[model samples]
Target chain A: MSAGLSIAREEWRLWARSRVVLLAGVIVAVLLVVTSALTALRVADEAEARAARQASAEATFLAQPDRHPHRMVHYGHYAFRTPPPLAAFDPGVDAVTGQSIFLEGHRQNTAMFADARAGADLGGFAGLTPANIYQLLLPLLLIIIGHGVLLRERESGTLAVLLAQGQSALTLAGGKALALAGVVGAFLLPVTALAAYGAARGEPALTAALMVAGYGLYLAVWAALILAVSLWVRQRSVALGVLIFVWLLTALVVPRLGINAGSAAIDAPGKIESDLVMLAEQRKLGDGHNAADPAFAALQKQVLEQYGAEKVEELPMNWRGVVAGYSEKKLTDLMNQYAEKRMAQEAEQSRIVTLFGFASPTLAVGAASRTLAGTDLATHHRFLREAEALRFDFVQGLNDLHATKLTFADDAKRSADPEAEKRTRVNAAAWRLLDDFRFVPDPAAARAARAALPLAMLLGWLVLLGGAIVAGARRLRP
Target chain B: MIPALEARSLSLVRDGTTVLEDVSFTVAPGEIYALLGGNGAGKSTTLLTFLGFLAPSCGSVLVNGRAVAEDVDGARSAIAYLPEAASLYGHLDAYENLGYFLDLAARKVSRAAMDEALDQVALPREARGRRMQSYSKGMRQKTAIALALLRDTPILLLDEPTSGLDPVAIDEFHDMLKGLADAGRSVLMVTHDVYGACQVADRVGLLRGGRLVGSFEAAAGERIDTETVHAAFAAREAA
Candidate 1:
């Protein structure tokens, strides 16, 4: 262990003395700091803007003039999908997906006002978030710095001296790996601080801890891989070339392959096609607009039976409002079925893409980081689901007022009689009955649960590469 | 007593090519034996087999009477190797490189002791603190010799130990090596310097085409004749 520490310390001294390597490390660290700051600012500005807009929306809803409850239903509220707090570290899919959904009656709305759609060239392959840098560039940096350590030993005749000193191959490899891990840890300084920062700010500690561990394992895999390859190849140039090729294969090429393969393997319906199918499916189901049609005659009979009314006018409440309530429920359920199916398809696509995480550490960490940050597709789907629930609740709340407040005769004669139309309007204060919509993210435990598979894959890579290093170290010769 | 270093019928074949044949030699304790050969004569190959860096196709090498193949660590623990053109870390000064390599051997030395070893090799005190990258070939060779000396092992393996030294330093190195041998250390050095081998070595073995062609041993208080070995070397190359 002392010998290993000696080598590790020597490696550090050598690196510090090397101006080029030190400069590269400084540059990467500066980039991480700058990107981290910029991402934090962007997330803050976005969250503030969304919150302000949401507040304004609620104020406008409550200030509405007296009107028929149906008109108030059309003045729908907006649920802004608030950025998950740790998005400063990893924006994930948040940049591409829309943030706000316009919740109204009858139709389920797609989210809107996405950063990508607003011409923000960010957060995907070109993403400069701290997570992106850690995932993509950190491994490359490790490869560039470590590709020559073992090769230099043989090239400089130091291996023979080291070996002749009773140093086993295992010790040499262990020492080299220790040195590389130290370098990687230096890179993680900002990451560790970011986690602590997130934890202090009330992001789930487990999620933050898992994110750091996932990256730790990921970098370990690279460190071991670099050492193993350097030990296996004797020539300096060959070791460097092979390591660079591997970096490109895993970092650049394999991730793209995963996405393309997932798309080809399980092609989900395009947005337009999905929308059209849902529209067609809705048409074949109950026509909520014609509440008095034969399609809802059974619903009318059920309502009458519940009220024990001899005639529609004789009932205590307006029958049209009752029909509105029943029809909306049936229509909402149909929409939910389609929405869930689409979500399932997308989740399947993600699953197919994630299987490639085994092929690339970049993919594994990216998946795990995004899921932990609550910036993944699953979170977005959750937002839509929550918005739909709010949509139904508010719409139903207005429908209930429609049923209880207005008389059946007043609603029927309102279009033809001006006096009845005035009386048919419910007070705008009724909008206060609706609750303000706040997006509650999935519990931290659930998000961590979802991240398990990719994190395990990262761990698996570490084990496989670590084992190879051990096996290869035994074969190392001067 | 068992010989401090021995190669019994040692042979090596690398990449389907014979690098060393069934050659045999041993250096007893307190003796200096030099294996002299021209380039590609399997001189370095012999040293590597003893270090367990390369496995011989047939036969075995032993250090301190233990087969190197069976207890490589044990064999290596007793030996200090100085490879040809022995490159120290250019990024580190002499003390740091020496300290690192010595530490790997699990030996501890004080700065004064390091300075002493450096002084014995005649490396100027002023140049010892500078990175070896700034040093000339001869200076680097001197630092490597210091490292090997500081290892304090029983056996020493020097591959072309005086390749870059001037006449004065080469003589100084030979005397230092002789002093180590006198102190009960065994030396097995491979070199193509016929005159230097005859000047310092107690026994000189001529290696030709992976075979030990001839050996010359000095009598007590006498040195091996250089011209005789040189002519044999020249004749073998001519053939």
Candidate 2:
């Protein structure tokens, strides 16, 4: 153990003295941190702008004059996106997913204006996150630093001397691994600091901890594998080349293969198709303009009977308001069902993706990060659900006000008489009664639970690589 | 008494091809034994077998009565190997590389002792502090000898140690080997230069067809000539 520590210390001293190693490590750390912090700020600004637009849309909806509740249902309401507070750590698929969802009486609208899969064909490769640094590029750097550990000694004819000195192959390997892990730790420190910073700001502490743990485990695999390959090869050049190949295959090749395979397995319906389907479904429900239809006429008769009215004018409630309330209820239910189905399809797609986390810890961590941040597909779906709920409440409230305040005769005649229509406008007090959209993210406890599986996989990797250390050490003995 | 280094009927087959077969030789303490052969004569192969770098397909290599392949570290600890071109970490200065090898060899000599070892090999004091990447061939060879001295092993194996040295350095290297022998160490040297072998070796062995086909002992009034040695090497090749 003392020998191992001494060797570890020696490696660190060498690295410190070697300008190239120190420069490479520092440059990568600085670049990743700066890029991550800047990107986080940019995303936060975008989210704020989106929220402001939502506020303006809500204000516009409230400014409307009094009208039949059914007409107000046709006018609809816009729901703005509420960005997750922890999204600065990892945006997940938030950029790729739609933010705002327009909810109306009859048709469901898929969230639109997502930035994912945007730009030219090659643009999608560089996802917006510090994860790429940890996942793809970091291993390559480890390979560069670690591949020559044993082979160089052999090439220089120093292995015999080292062996003669009571240094077992296991000891040498242990020392090298210790050295590499130290370098990997230095590389991860800055990113972990960023994550911890987010965690410090009331970001889910457990999720942040898990993220750090997962990344560390993943990089450990690289370090051990690098040493293993270096020991297995006869020449230092071959060792370096072989390790680079392994890194490329595992980090870049396999992940893209997994993502493409998942997409091929279950392709979600395109947005255009979803919109057309929602439209077709809405037409099947009773249209508000078709008052001659039996369903509409029956609804009107029911309202009169329920109020115990002798005639339309004798009724305290406006007939137009009653028509609008009934219209809003039917269409809102239709839109909600459509939404539920689309969200289900998206859930299916994401479920397939999450299963692949086992094959690649990167996928697992990516999923867990997004889920914890409330920036994953599920969160987007929830936001849409809440937005639709608010839309329903707003449209329905207007319908109820028309039914109670305006007489049936007054509502029916107001559409034809501009003067009466102007007088029928509801007071500002009524508009104030409409609720504003509020987002309640899934609880932090639930996020930690959601991240548990990936965290466990990451832990499993750490244990497995630790085992590799023992196994590789045994093989190195003369 | 056990030979300082010995191999009997040793064979090395790599990738289904026999590179060496039925190779046998022995070196006793206080003797400089030379292994002479043409290109591809397996001189380096025979030396590597003693170090256990290549496993023998048949028979065995023994260092001080222990099979080296079975006790690699033990055998390696007892010997120093200087390969052709002598690859020291080019990024490390001569002194640093020497320090590293000595450390590996389990020797804990002081920094001053390391400097003295380099001085014994006639290395320039100024060059000791510069990285080896800038060293000339003679400087590199001297540093390798300096490493061997610092290791203080009982046996030494040199593969073309004087290949690129100047006449002065080559003479100096042979004297160093002779001095090592006088101190009761054994040295096995492989070289293509027959004249140098005759000058430095107490006994010269001719390797042809992966076997030691001829050997001559050094004695008073019996100095081996280059022509006779070359003729013997060619005859072994023809046979």
Measured against the true two-chain complex, the DockQ scores of the candidates, in the order shown, are 0.81, 0.24
True contacts kept of 1: 0.91
lDDT of each: 0.86, 0.74
Cα lDDT for residue A194, model 2? 69
lDDT of 2: 0.74
How far in Å is the alpha carbon of B233 misplaced in model 2? 1.6
Off by over 4 Å in 1: A117-126, A301-311, B166-168, B219-222
Best by the DockQ measure = 1
Per-residue C-alpha lDDT of model 1 across residues A5-115, encoded as one tens digit per residue: 888888888888888898889989888988888788778877787778777887888899899998888888888877766888998888877789887888888787566
After superposing candidate 2, which stretches have Cα over 4 Å from the reference? A1-30, A58-82, A102-113, A116-129, A140-167, A232-256, A288-292, A296-329, A353-365, A403-409, A417-424, A433-445, A448-478, B102-107, B220-227
| Backbone clashes in model 1, listed as residue pairs | none
